[model samples]
Target: MTSGTSPQANAAAIVGAARRAASEGAAMLFTPEMCGLLDRDRGRATANIVAEADNPVLAAARDVARELGLWIDLGSLAILRDDGKWANRGFVIDAGGEIAARYDKIHMFDVDLATGETWRESAAYTPGDHVVTVETPLGRLGLAICYDVRFPALFEELGRLRCDAMRIPAAFTVPTGKAHWHLMQRTRAVEASAWVISAAQGGRHEDGRETYGHSTVIDPWGDVVLDMGEGSGLGFAMIDPARTAEVRAQLPSLANKREIPRSAS
Candidate 1:
């Protein structure tokens, strides 16, 4: 369950999805990254979005979570802060509609592709310094966003922290997603021995930018439990915490890890 449009619309869609999933006996609902505004023109996109702290959209989501009695993983929002800048922030809203925790995206997408896909997120947004993991009935959950999936060390750190699951909400470009999406995701799951729930933004937007939408949920054994493909729809999977324990017990890779020094330029 994710969105790639206006904040209000995204918020409404999330509430609807949450209600529907709850009716079907779902305990939690997760969303996609940048679940608010999407503008091809970066300048204009920043202008149209809201601040995370007092956003009407987030408020609505909180209300819905409270009313539905389900946990809501509000995907990353473009939050305009008082410092005249924005942050890519994710929120975990409890069943009671209270904010359980917040995780800001630490890895900024700063790439220059041969396909003319150039992005320097750090130019416009600040990076988060802290790693965030939250406790839930399911297990300890680590939080991440789009480009963060490229870094395996993050997942390993979460594994070291004893996290059972990780969430990656993305709006990946078609070219990149096709080349490395599944491989990267599965690799992370295998290395960390944790389940991954990745909700993605799919289809071309009104702004003319295309997203590679293959919302996937992978198990600890590196198997894709569900894949939503390149379309607009909901994908669901039941995650068993025992699977993580089983996998880790079978192959304890974490205990054999060693730190090595690197040369500095």
Candidate 2:
């Protein structure tokens, strides 16, 4: 979704997407990172970045989730934490409108791009410590955000937990997205022996930032099941739990994994 600076507008978009997804027989809907509001200007964003309890986008999503009896994975929201700091938080709302799980994005996207784009994510958002996962219609779903996809250790831990599927929603820059998005996604799915579903922000947003929007889904076997390239719309793919079993039986990498010893000084 090309989420804008207005939280109300973004909320409406999420609600409409959920209704449409439910009408089409989808048990769950996944959204991109910063689905509630994406603004480069921190000062302007501060007004909309309220506590999770007061976030309109989250409130609307819960209402719609209950109304349609569908689960909605809000990719991530800019939330004002109780500690008075901010957090990049993601939510998994169950079909009953209850918050099943919440994940604070651990890996911050602090980088300088070749295109002269600089980001200091850790400057505004505090990093999360714990790894989070939950059970849903998609099986045991491991939760992660944009930059978290680049860290293999996180996915390795999720694999250790035997997650059946993982969601890594993102709002990636065009340059980096072109370079590592699909490669890293397929690798994570293959390594974990789990399905990877990533809904992404596409097109230019209201804040004048363009996202690399190839919202993708890859099966456990590293096959591309769905790729919504540079588009903003809902796409679907069928997931077979047996496929995960098949891949694990064939590779068994997770089973064979061992801790690597530190290099001798």
Candidate 3:
């Protein structure tokens, strides 16, 4: 979604997507990072960034989820933490409109790009310190956010937990998306022997920032099942749990994994 600075507008987009998804026979819907209110301006964003209970976008999504009887993986929202900091928090609302799980993004995107774009994510958001997963219609779903994809340790933990599918929603920079998006996603799926479903933010947004919008899905075998290239819309793909089992049986990487010895100085 090309989520803008307005919480109301973003909520509408999410509700519409949920309706469309349910109508299309989808049992679940996944969105991108900052699915609600993607305001880069910290000062301006402060007004809209409220606690989770008070967030209108989340409320609307919950209401719609209950009405439609659909599960929604709301990619991530910028939430005002109680400590006066912020959190890039993702929510998993079950078909009953109840929050089944919440995962705050652990890896902060602090980088200076050659494209002249610099991000100090840790400056605004406090990182979370837990690996979270939940059971859904699609099976055990592991959760992670945008920049978290860069760290393999997180995915290793998800693999160790034997997640059936993983969600790595993002609003990626154009340069990095072009460079490592598909490669990293496929690698993660192959390494874990799990399905990877990544919804993404696409197109130019209201805050004058452009996002690389290739919302994609990769099977356990690292094959691209869906790629909604450079657009702001919903897409769908079928997942087979049997395929994950098949791949694991063939490679057995997870079974063969042994604790690495400490590196010598």
Candidate 1's residue-wise lDDT over 12-56, tens digit each? Answer: 887788888889888888888887666657766765666766686
Clashes of 2: 0
- Per-candidate TM-scores read 0.94, 0.98, 0.99
Check candidate 2 and list the clashing pairs.
Answer: none
lDDT of 2 by residue, 1-265 (tens): 9989999999999999898889999999999999999999999999999998999999999999999999999999999999999999999999999999999999998999889999999999999999999999989999999999999999999999999999999999999999999999999999999999999999998999999999999999999999999958989888889899999999999899999999999
Off by over 4 Å in 3: none
Output the lDDT of residue 13, model 2: 93
Better by lDDT, candidate 3 or 1: 3
Cα-based RMSD of the predictions, in order? Answer: 1.9, 0.8, 0.7
Q: What is candidate 3's lDDT per residue for 1-265, written digit by digit as tens?
A: 9999999999998999999999999989999999998988999999999999899999999999999999999999999888888999999999999999999999999999998999999999999999999999999999999899989999999999999999999999999999999999999999999999999999999999999999999999999999999979989999898999999999999999999999999
Cα lDDT over the full model 1: 0.83
Candidate 1's TM-score reads 0.94
